[model samples]
Target chain A: MTSKSSRREFLTRSVQGVALTATGGLVWSYLLQQQAHAAPHAIRPPGAYDEAGFNAKCIKCGQCVRDCPYDTLKLAPTGEMVAIGTPYFIPREIPCYMCEDIPCVKACPTGALDHSLEKIEESRMGLAVIDIENCLSWIGLRCEICHRVCPILDKAITIEHHPRKLSKHARFVPLVHSDACTGCGVCEKACPTEIAAIRVVQPELVQGKIGEHYRLGWKIDTPITQEFKAPKRKDGKDTPATGLDYLNQGEI
Target chain B: MAVDNNTVKPDTVKLGPNGKPVRPFVMPSTLVGKLKVWRYIIYRRIVQLGSLLLFLGTVHWGWSIAGEPLLIGNLSSSTLFGIVPLADPFAVLQIFLTQHLLEQEVVIGAGIVLLIYTLLGGRVWCSWACPINMVSDLASWLRRKLSIKDSFILSRNIRYVVLALSLILSVITGIAAFEWVSPISMLHRELIFGIGMGWMAILGIFIFDLLVLRDGWCGHLCPLGAFYGVVGKVAPIRILFDTPTCTHCSECVRVCPEPKVLNFKKAAEVGMIASGDCTNCGRCITVCPENTLAFGLRVQSNISKKSSNKLESNLRRAT
Candidate 1:
């Protein structure tokens, strides 16, 4: 009778312990969720997947941080409230050198940094936006520092000729093309302005999303006449007015 | 009797209140005896310290110790010699939870780690490699010294629940939930990169063990250790009890961090410590005055012969 009672007691205790532990875990996860949502998104190393995919895949090992030659990457410190132990870089302090071999991506054991990005230029780490109001080039100065320092050279940042009424020479406007830009932050790092005239921003934050329903008809290279046959009017009306007829009708 | 008279000095034996000889906490006098006792401990300490130093050397000092530039990495995941891949199984499990596909290299790496732990005993990582073990050990020692009697007992099976919850949480949250708050990873980061608020978590664990519970974090709550315990269930290396030489002092129980593994009554009947929770830490062997405990293979044929040999020797000493 004593043995049976003791066994029952043990079972109760085991159940209670399990309940307590589960509660602790759920509370911890709740705290983590709150912090994670509150924390701002950080710029991950080159070849990092989109935010959700990267968070799911990254093991937070700090391998990429160790592999970065220029010390461009750092494991998210505890206070940052970003995903703990995951690697991120502060561009103003140290910008990615955009090494041809892409050592950081190679070092990732898990495919957190997509291994498919073979070329350095292929990485869309972030996009650089030039603040024209603060830019010396916009203020009647010949500062083409961002264009010169860009790793992609003329492909990423091109100097557009802006005719200045006050100055004799044309103002060189550094236009950043999203396609060629890897957001290496070399231009931001090299900017001579007191506050940087150009800065690297997360592509998701800055890049505008196009409406899913919108489609460009002109994107197709083939002639429209070859691709589509003119439909007969369902109302048995005259054939649809041509472009020239519509223009003449408005005039008349 | 002749050997006993020559070796057993009255002065060397310190008596407790009950007139039994106090258990020796120090190393054995003879070199071979000391080696048998301290070998596992020394190896474990060296491994734990070496692993920490390698990480610190690479991340902080930027020393190219591994020859190849930027080849090796932190403890959680790394490549040895720039070719052989290695990853922590828990880390891989988190990735598998969300991604639902394990990379070829990650699978190979986890497999290598699993195979090694299977041979060496899975919780050997807890004893030998985990940095958090050192902290818990310190807490245990302090508790023993201070004679802190108040202990909040929680079920050891709680760790399994915690383990399951952590994996589930990882899947739900899309983050390595446990690793985010893990003091082990936090301590590693603190050592390489300076500490911020993470040190509080380590301190909380230490205080929890010291004041609130005994061996609470690693024994009861750590999902990582719980996972490893499951892996090490059938580990061949175990503590063999020669019941003939056992004086029944229960000193091994007193010293053992996991006292349930030593099960003196069961060990006397079975002639071996068969508990999967046994870390093969060799602590029981170190504290046993009779020296009945030794690291041995748990094979059926060898047990009877070994016990008979030990009995004969013990009988001679008794006479």
Candidate 2:
């Protein structure tokens, strides 16, 4: 009788363990997929508690809504009364300008907006992520404006060296420096593509979670110089090449 | 000599022709003389004492605002009479809890005070001296100037929706959203000197009163008014009518801003007249020229039965 009962318990435990393992595996896979697709995006700068904080300590007073330079923010409606006066920016119509000196941060009296950021790069508005599939350069075309206009330039925006195979013309494409990118979204603004090949979403870890490790990564992750070698033309006289040549040029 | 007409009833009473002093009249019936309605009026006065204190306390708070913050909730003593630079206290509470002081004791205390008073007096806050009611009264006065037609909207149940929303949002966001509906806060900010158009909005309503609708916004849209309506449901004191003396001239109904009180005339019995909308403003009593109405008390939970025709006649003969 003892052996029979023990066998039944063992069978129950095996079934339960198998079910748990399958569920865990599915959850792990889903998380992995999400992480793979997710890239850092822009975030509202931290207020009061962090640098570039809005001081109003803000009581969520609606004063900021009336005073916003861009009128990008409004009262969140009675239903959203909790969020009341906190401002949120919509990137499609009005994105954060990454002003060399933050103006809104200074306007806040209660420390809802923080005015302490000295460098534009140090201000984490959010991070910019490139959709390689949608990016013009990744399509073997000639768009590198994002890398060029990036405020930190070589520090924040860098190029990857990839050799293309077709004709006797220019070669290589520009890759992004993700770590240096503050996701100020200026590049998304500068993108010549009509539909805007790049866009921004709020990044996880929010703003102000950066510690010594993040700062260290910012310093060491400077782009490798060789990757930025200019695309060479057959004539090689520093002549700007055509968009077509940029596509097939065995670019490096 | 008109002996039957002139003889005063032992149990019944008569107000002098002027409607102020009372004279005892001969008992018209056995039933109402036994009820002894005058005792109930005295009871109402007892309740009114507490109501009067609440009104004075609210005003006294205004006097203290020089040192205190404009809004309610936990605040630091160093915050200048518990006043912070921020006009509202939700932000202060947020800052406090983050610092681990858990200063929520003060806010909870204020909530208890409001709850106890509401259960007792039934929106006595509105009838006596809620700043919002004061503003509504001002708006009603303006309604006479504008001659706005159809000003009072029948929205008795709307306040429950508002209170529920306020509680739900407060729970969800951990911030006090009800400050917007606080009449004292609005009055202090808008009527007294303050920066910005928040004041303008309140004043603008008066200006709007000039164009169309009498106290249109306050009568229809004031969430605070709605809250008072809901809280007054269980009020123990009410304005009971001696219906036979009610000449059916509709003067009381026409004068009553609260439609529920007017609807009470149609009710079966003039027992406890406490509905959610009773403000205990005494406006009905003030306007009743016939001396047919008086404030009365009842058992805490009794639903009054319709007064009999004979009882109504007794009330008329007594008055």
Candidate 3:
């Protein structure tokens, strides 16, 4: 109220206001660039959409964070590495429990989480990967903690028998199948390593795609064998027996 | 509110050596009269705190009816009875600006909220529903009680520019720009769901409002309030200025949070406070000793011809 409200002064303030707004907005955008990019791999709750879809659709209401009974999910606040206000979990600290009811997804007002994911087993929140170097089973120690704790059991994580050098024993290595693993982080939490040997991460980080055109000829499902069948001899008869066969017949 | 600047009852005001009213706005004799003075404030508190209670109760304590959680989300987006959806329209608009179309439920929810505020007056959300209002109100109240002088001057129009910038930045940033950084959202969301570094930002707002300027955030810097102001333009509910009863005591102007909206010449030209900036908080109505202001339908605010003519002549003479 102390300032004069002359016409020229009003225009000057208008220009100043615009300049301030633009400068402030740019600063805010810079913060967004630093903060809102959804961290390296903040594992989401079950039924979350693809990262891009989830980022766009999530209203940041924290309903999913609120409804998670196990408190596995947290709304990323100002200081977290995840996109600010989006629901994410640190698997090593508190992994998704893979609740049968999928309460968190149900609580999402928007379908940032896929509502159609009725069974929690089907929700690929992330992919669990093993660090072979640190894994107890890989080191020939008897630690199958990850395999034992996986909710999907033998289907999601099965043990592979690998023969050890100069020993009659075999190392039972736990294998995580992308097809069945829900990435619930149970295995990550249960691992007995100093730091978790098995960890959940966004699938794209480790998973490789067998391109659509590639074919495994050895697999029964692929029919490359038929295409590679050699043409029949022009004579339509078998070739003469080799020298070994002829000698064997002559009793040499 | 400044006690000296509040409404002066004709009999209650003491005359000073110069015969000017001093120590205006004395307390009433009866408890009911005192309650009448704070009726709107009490209702506002109930609405604001009641909303928070609903969210807190539902989230923390399993408050439900017929197996349905009540008001699951915070103010950004929520569902009533797990059926009727509600969302902040401005947030939705920012998301929309990001080129991401929301689900029909949220889109409809935004529409429902917009329609309600459009009818009730947009900043009604600010006074009646926003939790930040309580903080801002406390700041202003303490300022008046403690006689805190504003450290700086700011334009009320800055909020509109901020609103525009938020939308533009949303497009550029590929996210809800304001929603990401908004202290309003941070405070309510963190309070309802969980605690984080959110309170630090809200604390900044409180200090900024309390010490730097009176009604600084709500009146001058909140893009959400500005968005609602634009949405609630031509709102059916408005503060009708009764020209005949007004004594030109200037109390309403002093008490008004958005005092510029109560322009006397403009209100005289039109029989109502026509600015979308009027929050319909009814502070002016409550403080008017002469009953000069009241809520009325905007369409029906055409004053009686005699009063209109008188106000027009007064306006001319004053000019």
Candidate 4:
């Protein structure tokens, strides 16, 4: 071993080490940044925390993947896409069966899958959105496999009356209500089209906020607010509001 | 025995062409000698491969004891018998440094691992359990066979710098920095659960260790190993050094992956391998022709076997 190095040699070695470390750090940090932000569509196991929290807390152990009875979960491999080594499921191939016990979440050592999610109905892995134009029910067919297979049943997916162009009988279309939908993706898997008419996606992708101001007062649940009420005329007779005329009658 | 180097006995092994004793990794001529030589290695393989099999069996084969699954998850975190949790302390520390609220199971798991490793000599995980060891071990073996020498020098202390950087990055990135990109996890997680491009990272480490340097990844760059080395400072299990009987054969040095841990002068004065960096792999113990090295309790200051025996019995006594 060298007892000592000259000042020039020592400086050169120091610079080399620093340069190597800096280069490695730059590349590594870029990788972490990309990996963290990528894979937005990944449907996590039941009772998963929000995307950010799940990514932060999930130890990437794949325990949940192993525990899933239906083989619904898979740990994202090093390079494919979803947060590497974190569990995710492609609903089209094999959607979550919505097991009553939720073995996948139960197997998670870290609370990446929240323990508080005692009931399967409480899980919100993603939202089920329908392609209105391409759906068989919308195209005037009797197909409602998605509605039939949904574990939440009528509450999650309800067959509503749709007026058809020519047919005397009304068309029954499957309408997914977010209030009861657990996003289990059974509908996505059960759809018989070459491409699924209904698909599961992160709720933020399609869900829009009505904001705080717009309240529909026509519904029975909506409180009678004075903002939309008719004003009294000089003769003591009320003049009906003009816009959105159907809601003006106030008879319910 | 106080055997002189000049007068090697007929029963004893001869020195190499360069006058150094044979490395322990080399197969011996006699059948009994060959079997004895690979004792530690065989046991390590059994442990490493057996644990992996248990995890795989529980998952794919429905292996269970009394209807409870045995061993779930990889080295980063795991559960045994569907009850006791075991997690990598280094990973838990990284995530903890990120300031995220970790669950109690992972915390308890980390504590359990930390306690077990602390008493067993911490790098027991590296040599005995870490799947990466097999890759690096193969690389080092191939390096010897191919007569490949290190292209550059790297300080073994570099891993501590990396450990510090990982923690700092965890705080900055709001995630476990090392856990995100660890080749160790890539290899272990992918192999057991399913396929992935993780094999590419494994291949990279293998090539780097084989061609760039001897024991490059594990010895010089693995922050996990460095963390365990620090934890091993207070470990009770240690390699006992009997300096008087030593022939200065240097076989232990050649065989050991971490050769500096066997600094003879320091080990002689201390009466044991005192370096925290020592992995306690027992290569030195198996290789020493004079039986100069051994696996024993961390002795106080006994240079002789008789006094060390007395100390061991005294410590072992119930009273």
Worst 10 residues of 2 chain B by lDDT: B72-81
Instruction: Write down the C-alpha DockQ for each prediction.
Output: 0.42, 0.04, 0.44, 0.54
Please give the CA lDDT of all the candidate structures. Answer: 0.77, 0.47, 0.82, 0.84
- Weakest 10 consecutive residues, lDDT, candidate 2 chain A? A47-56
> lDDT for model 4, on a 0 to 1 scale?
0.84
Candidate order, TM-score descending: 4, 3, 1, 2
Q: Report, in order, each candidate's fnat.
A: 0.56, 0.04, 0.59, 0.69
Task: Find the number of clashing residue pairs for candidate 4.
Answer: 0
Question: Model 3 segments beyond 4 Å from truth?
Answer: A1-17, A99-101, A116-119, A208-252, B1-24, B29-32, B303-307, B310-319
| lDDT, candidate 1, A74-97, per-residue tens | 887677756677788877789999
Higher TM-score: candidate 1 or 3? 3
Predicted structure 2, TM vs. truth: 0.41
Question: Can you write out model 2's per-residue Cα lDDT over B19-97, one digit (the tens) per residue?
Answer: 3334223333565653452343344445544433432333234324666433321111112233332222232433333
Candidate 4 backbone collisions, by pair: none
DockQ of 3: 0.44
Candidate 1 Cα deviation (angstroms), residue B213 = 1.2
Q: Is the docking of candidate 1 incorrect, acceptable, medium or high quality?
A: acceptable
